[model samples]
Target: MQAQRQLLFGMYMDAMRMDEVIEHCRTALITRRPILLGVLNAAKVVELRRNAALRESLMECDLLLADGQSIVWASKLLGRPLPERVAGIDIFSRLLLLAHKEGRSVAFLGAKPDVLAEMLHVVARRFPGLKIAYSHHGYYEAAEAGQIAAGIRESGADMLFLGMTSPKKEIFLGSYGASLGVPVMHGVGGSFDIMAGLTKRAPIAWQKCGMEWAYRLLQEPRRLWWRYLKTNTSFAQLTAREMFHPDHPFLAGANHRVTSGSPMLPDAQLRSIADD
Candidate 1:
C-alpha cells in the first residue's frame, strides 16, 4: 500500500495520525520495513535538528511530529502548520488503547523498578485486553544493555517503550530497535513515573499556559535548575530575536509570516485561547 502524504513546511510526509502510527507498526511487522517516530519540541530540540547529520537522520525517518505547540506555531510560520501537536504522553496512551483493542503485545524497558511496575499495572488496568510481553527495570550499563535487548527480542513484543533519558533512548532506538524486531519504539523520558501516579503532571491550565516547566522546577529545583536555566535562556533569546527581526534566522522563507504575534509566543497563544 502506498503511504498517504501531506505537504508540510518544506517537507513531504505521511499525514501524522495517532491511530495510524500504531497501524504503521503493525504494517511494518508484516512487510519487514523500517520506520521511525521522531518527536520534536520545536523550542526545546529544534536546535538539535539544525546539525546536518541530525537533520538528515530525522528527515530520513518515516514520521516526524510537532510534539510541542511551539513547533506547531513554527510550522505555521514555515508554511506547514502541523495538523496538531502530538504530545508523547498522549500518543503513548493512544497507542496502548489501540494495542488493547487489537490484542497486540508490548514491552517496556527502562525507568526505576517501582516506576516501571506501577506503570505496567496502570497500563494493564487501563487497557484490559492489551498484553504486556515483559518489562525490565532500568539502570543497566552498556554491557548489560545486550541482555535487555536480548530479552526484548525473546519476548516477541511488537512495541517497546524506552523510558531512559534523552540521547540515550534515541541512541538505543536508532541502534537496536530494528535488530530487536520491535517495530514501534518511543522514548518516553520520565513518563513512567507520571503515568504510574508516582509523579504528577502539571495542572492542565499551567500546561496550556506553557508554565508546566515552572511547576516542574518548583518541584525539583536542585536537579532541574541548570538545565532549565540553559534551555529557558536559549528559548528567550530565540523568541526575542524572532519577534523583533523581520529576517530572523529561524523564520527564513519557510511558512506563514509571524510578525503579528505577541512578544512572547505562548502568552500570545494563551491569550487567544482564553478569548475564544
Candidate 2:
C-alpha cells in the first residue's frame, strides 16, 4: 500500500505492488466497498485521450495500475518511477488464487456464451475450493441490465469479474456495479478467451521485453496491427517529448526512485472513486 499520489500524463496513479493488490482485494471482500481497478496500458492511455466518457469513468476508479511496461518506463523517464507494472490478466489470476484460498464466492459476467462456459470450467479446475455463485453471457439486452444486476446482487458473490469489451464494460460497471452489491469487481476484457484456451498470452520472453503488443499483433494482425502501431507510436512519441522537457515537475524532484513502501488510500476515498 502506498500513500503518496503521483500525477503522470495527467492522471493520478497509485504506487502499489502485486501483493498490495491482493491484500486490497481480500480486504474489500469483507468491507463491502468494491474496488474498481483500471489497468492502464499504452493503448488505453491513447483511448482515454480520445474517449472522455471512458476516461472519466476509469479515472473514478479506486486504483489505476500500470498494465503496460511502457507506463513503468514512462514513470522512470518522468523521474517519479513506479515500482512495477501490475498486469491486469496477472492480477486476475492472483485474486482468484486469493478467493480460492479463502473459500470465497465469485460471479462471472461477460464473454460469448461458449467462452464463458469454458472459462467456468477452467476456473473450477484451477480453483477447486472456489464457489461460483452465478454467471451470465455478455449478450444481454440493454433492458436486461437491471435484472442482471439484481441476479448478481442476489447471488451473494464477494467478487465479480466482467469479461466484456470496452466502453460497454466500463459503462456498465460505472453505472450499475455498486447496485450489484459485490465487494470486488474487475473488467477483464478478453481474459476469458485466454482462460478458455481459445487464445494464448505472449511468451514470458516477449512480455519481459515489453513486446506483448507485438505478439498480439502477430496473432491477430487483422484486428490489432493498426491499433497497436498507431497507439504505440503515439505513446512513444509523446513519452519521448515529455521525458526531454526541461520544466517537467517530476524531473526536478529529488527523490524519484520510490520502491515498495507506504500506506493505503482511505476507505472514504476508495468508496468515492468506486462510483463514477
Candidate 3:
C-alpha cells in the first residue's frame, strides 16, 4: 500500500500511476477493505480552498488521482511531479473492463434518471457480462442519502461509482461510504453523462494538447466558460505563490516524517472530515 505522494497547494495527491491505481483497487477488492477514491482537478482544487470539508474528504480517501491536465502540470512546476494524469473518465472505463474480466459486480449512484438509464444500457451493451449490482439517479433528497447508502451496501457490490458533483459527492462518500461496505468506491464527476452518450468528451487532439478545458468551454460556454476561466487563473496564481513560498504550512513535513517501514503518511485531514 506504500506509494509516493506530494502535497500540492494544501492537497495530498497520489503520485501512483494508472496501473498502480488499478492494482490498488484490485487488491482492495480481494482484501475486502474500502478504498475511497477521489480525483483532483483545477476546479476541485480551487473549491478546496473555500471548502474545508471537501478538502478533508479528499484527504481521507485512500487514493487521490490527478484528473485534470492542469493538475499534472502544476505538480511538475512545484518540483514534485506526478508520474502522469490519471483522468477519472479513463479510470472509470478501464475499471469497467476490468470488472467484466474479473466478474466483479458494480453499483452506480447519481446522474439524471434518463442519463442514468442510458448509461446503464450503454454499459450493458459495451461490457457484456458486466454485473450491475444497483443504480440510482442523483435526484434523491438529502434525507435519503442513508437509504441510498444502505441499498448500495445490500447489493453486495465490489465497486461503486458515484457520478455526483463536488462537495455533495465527497460528503456523501465521507458520511456513508465505509458503511456501504463497497471495497472500491470512486467519485467520478460527470462521467456518467459521457458514458450515456448524452455528452461528448473532448477530441483526442484537444486532450493531447491539454486544451480539453477549452473544448469543454466551447461546448457549453454559458454554463462552463466563466467557471473554468476563474478556476484556471486561480490555480495558476496559487501554484506560482506556492512555488515562491515553499514554506507554506502545508509544505511542512511533520506528518511526512519517516515511519516504521511504510512511506505513506497518516492523514490528519481525513480525521476531520466529519467536522463539517
Query: Model 3's lDDT to the true fold?
Result: 0.79
- Candidate 2 per-residue lDDT, tens place, 1-276, comes to 354566776577888888888888888887878888877766555445445556666766788888888898888888878888888788889988988998888899988899999999999999986889999999899999989999999999988888876656777888787688788888877777788998788899998888777787788788655555556676676676555642233221133332222112222222112110
lDDT of candidate 1 over 1-276, digit per residue (tens): 654544432234454656667677668656756566766553324233233333343444567665565655555564544566666676677777767777778889878888888888888788876889979887778888878888999998877887765445656676676778776777665677778997677898976765666777788788666655655455445545444442322222234333333222332221111100
**Best of the candidates, TM-score:** 3
Summing lDDT over every window of 10 consecutive residues in candidate 3, give the lowest-scoring window.
Answer: 267-276
Worst 10-residue lDDT window for candidate 1 reads 267-276
Question: Where does candidate 3 stray beyond 4 Å?
Answer: 247-276
**How far off is residue 211 in model 3, in Å?**
1.1
Q: Which residue runs does candidate 2 get wrong by more than 4 Å?
A: 244-276
TM-score on alpha carbons, each prediction: 0.72, 0.84, 0.88
Prediction 1 global C-alpha lDDT: 0.61
Cα lDDT, model 2, residue 263? 17
Report backbone clashes per prediction.
5, 0, 0
Better of 1 and 3 by lDDT: 3
lDDT score at residue 121, model 2, on the 0-100 scale: 91
